[model samples]
Target: MSSGIPYTWDTDCIRASATCRAEGRLGKGTKHHPLEIQSTTTKKVVYLSDSGSSSLHTVGERMDWKRLTLVFCWLECASAAGISCRNEQGQAVDWYILYKQPSINDENGLVYLYMDESTGGWVPAHNPIDDQKSALAQTLLPLFQHFTNETINFGYILYNDQPPEPFKTASSSFGHSKGLVMMDQETGIWLSHSTPHFPGFDITGFWPNSGYANGQTFICGTYKYSAFRNIAVQLQYIHVYSFDAYIPEYFYPELQCVVDKGCYPKKTPWDRQLNMTSLGGHSFISYAKYSRYHDDLYSGLLDKHLESAFYAKSWGRLLDPLPSNCSVDFSVYNVETVQLPTTEPYSITKDHSKWCVTMDSKLHRWTCIADMNREVSQEHRGGGAICTDNAAVWSAFLDIVNTYQPCQS
Candidate 1:
């Protein structure tokens, strides 16, 4: 995996395309031949011609051959139906984080910094954050292109605190989280972001105008299909306000309840924690809390679970932001200023991103991207955090903390 390289989109297949339904083969037999085929038959198998022609010659038991083809088609469809996180270059990545800078000092907020496993530190984005070729847009290409596909193989759920037009008001008790989950039966991407009304219900110009003023962050990871079961269960704890969702009726029975209004929890466990593994084998921990929890996310939950002091960065426009606290075993401080490697330092007032990292890199290097803000009102809201201890990810976040407020007492 390398950065600063132009991606060639011509070599890749159209992900989740209904026209490319898994039959015996799926792909245009162009120069390199990206088609994947597997069939058990007595007839001799022939490779697709370089002229982009589908050719097959075989003679055997008619009914048996048809049965074998149908069986293979099912297998092929499952294997070919993949939805993963794509990078700026249109290449698949295990995970990536984007930090969109605040539009201060006569600059548009479209400027952002990008980091992934390959990039040791934050790299200045080559294009505007909302551009089609940017990392976020490329990763969402599948959702934008196939949202209305008639195939039952695709599934998605778009949730946010501030929904799109006609339904902008969100429930006060719902989670403050904002993100979208989209995927096929094989694999999918879980993108957790800190922008309001982003990638809205309508596909036309997904980015919202309100997001241009404050800084925001996005963390995306690709996970296997089975992992969504745990993820779906956790979303219930978060009590997400899903603005738009398309959960296929027959496929992914575990996800059906997510969009089902009747299935929303009334009184159950206030919170839940689950461990998940990405398709690339990276481990992540999801910590979710319901409104019934009635506590601050970082000091009351994360600090105790991880047993490490934290420097949290959250939206600074709150009416009464919680100050740094040293009352707990693991103290939690508020980040006041941020300085990215490629950008000038800015106050938290210009940023709305919610994230935190361990104060000491020696003992604990946990980094979390969450939706909860350190404030009085948010204490009663349902929200959650996704955390990882990956060294690269930790370092990238740790390096951005330029200043923070210490315990006042």
Candidate 2:
């Protein structure tokens, strides 16, 4: 593996991918998938981004809501979604997906950490009256309507996921007003990690929602949620981030690792550490393997929830109907049980065909491309996941991850 890529993958994927390239079917990107964490400080935070140009550019705490209005005016949307990251050259980038404000309600909400004395910026959410979603599609969506060829296949949700009261501080970065916490502007990384990805207000525990050691985990995998074939194309770098803010993935009733801690959830067989996603059907399959706790391998039965956490959130809250100014195709879901062949080997879909979207095994919790349209109908089970499917998005995400793999020394 090369130093540029962030994680490792199953040997079989590596071999088959190598074979594909050898057969003139595909080219290669980074090899080693280096684990990266860009240095962040008062001056800069390399790994996160949001609506504000800077991580500190929030609605108000000690400052004014000037910047939010500015973006609201230009981007023309109130609800929006975004990410903060550094490109390959280590340049900080704030990428956002927003919508034009609706005529009836053009105001985007500022999720302040507090009720008064502070306000986070008004994040953008597309307005169906002007912007496009289903029609325009992701890759087809241009970076700028005014003038730019950059595509928007990856920017999906764009709204303020604020924290609720009793949680508000009024003077903190992402100043508390409602139930919301982006990477704290004061702390550096933009919002989005502290809370689990629940439909509304899942950040009851902390801030920097997806940061390391929050009794949560981050899983990465290519999606098979929408269209099967389109997602499979980007098989090399699918990442599904799972956070256990709700409960540690490895909790067990009989395992001694599960200790009583009334102050917190039971002490796990393992203590607080970062989490990962196996992308395999751990939730659906029994006795699979997984990765967790500073990247250690764990039994799937020990922490099935870790690999299965993504399904806990509702896709309805995160997904927006296709807007006009946008050219992006999206799909994501989860279910309790399944109707798909229990015996069929996991595979990635190709040419509109259904295949198993298996999780990468070599790496602990992992991500990979899989079949999307492949629907194994279930009679009485439920789970969920959200994914954006587009060859362009798949390509763009890989490029973005490669470019944003963080500077790990």
Candidate 3:
């Protein structure tokens, strides 16, 4: 479809453009010609007034009207939809990552760490919910408003093993998955997270305080309509959610089972393996649990002869871990203390981040973020992981392994 407006700027110009866009006074420009303001005056100073207005002042100097106009257009579009994750052109992007840090010494509460290709690395978010410039808020605010905006015309499914209080008893066989999906005919996003009892009902605009007690992570990816077909496959493997909500009008035949039977049919043959490509150009492999493939993700991968190591919260079934076979080295990740590349050292417990890394230095490094733990009880449950071999993602996750408990022989 249309890529929207074409404008690019550095960090400083981006901030200024965001301000201009939020105020809604950016002049017009088209793809054929760049933005240009024909002014004879020399040095002109454009600044925002305390009342939040953009004003231009002329001095005895030359100024770049074309550059200024581009900035204005860029920021205007960026601010048009409120605070949202942005691309290099200061336009909204399709995917983003948000990490919630636990309340540590001197830290106030939940701190949001945001990242997109434009920003490259993680940046601290000023506000997670209301900040108009925040990627997380930008991506989520629309979904929150969808509850009241009937004309918005989008399809959504919100699932959590521990759902909001109203619909807790809906499904007991669902895997321990927490996520939400919102889409239309063209594009949409899938937000996979580790927080329980979250995004609260349409009425509650606040995050549950309990989520702040430990470290949590969320990954949101925007994808073309075609990608949802693969997503639907993954959801089928997840079985069901503790609580789920979907609109029948948006259901494709593949996903109609969710709306009709409350879950996929018991006998429906589904692919146990899938490769999902995100809009951001990231690739992930999803492994589903079914009939002969009853083994856990690590063991299943091991059976294929892929050697790897895993890191997960050890509270559930730490003692009954899968042994390290000749090809795979499975282990439990311990985080008594964590030192990450982007943040300071902090202690955490009950961290729900499920991920693993291949340890074979000779082989291509592989990293996977999953929805299930390594506990014995979870072996029987249906869940999956999205794996990638991106080095940056690998480095970011690898640096956090302070210690691990190796599997017994």
Q: Estimate each model's TM-score.
A: 0.81, 0.18, 0.71
Per-residue alpha-carbon lDDT of model 2 for 1-409, expressed as tens digits? 2234222111112222122111222212232221121111111111112222321222224324453333221121111111122121112222211111111121321111110001121222232211222111211121121023222222222111132332322221111001111121111111122222222221122223222211111112211223212221111011112111221223222111111111212223322222221123112111111112222112112223333211111111222311111111111122111111111121111011111121222323322221111121210111112222222222322221211111122
Top model by lDDT, which number? 1
Across 1-409, the per-residue lDDT of candidate 3 in tens digits comes to 1133333222233354443333333344334433333223233344443344443434545545555554454445444443233433345675666666665663544666766655555667766432344454446555555565542446677777777666663354666677777676666777777777776654344366566655677777777667777687677777647355555465565555543435553664432677777666767666666322455655554224334444543222255755443343454343345555445675545355666666545565666666666656667666666666666566566676665555445
RMSD of each: 8.6, 25.5, 7.9
Residue range with the least summed lDDT across 10 consecutive positions in model 2: 110-119
**Cα deviation in Å at residue 40, candidate 2?**
59
Off by over 4 Å in 3: 1-91, 105-108, 118-122, 128-134, 169-171, 201-206, 242-244, 248-251, 265-271, 290-293, 301-337, 342-348
Candidate 3 global CA lDDT score: 0.55
Q: Which ten residues in a row have the lowest lDDT in candidate 1?
A: 3-12
Model 2: lDDT of residue 34: 19
Model 1, C-alpha of 84: deviation from truth (Å): 0.6
Model 2 residue 355 lDDT? 13
Two-way TM-score contest, 1 vs 2, winner: 1
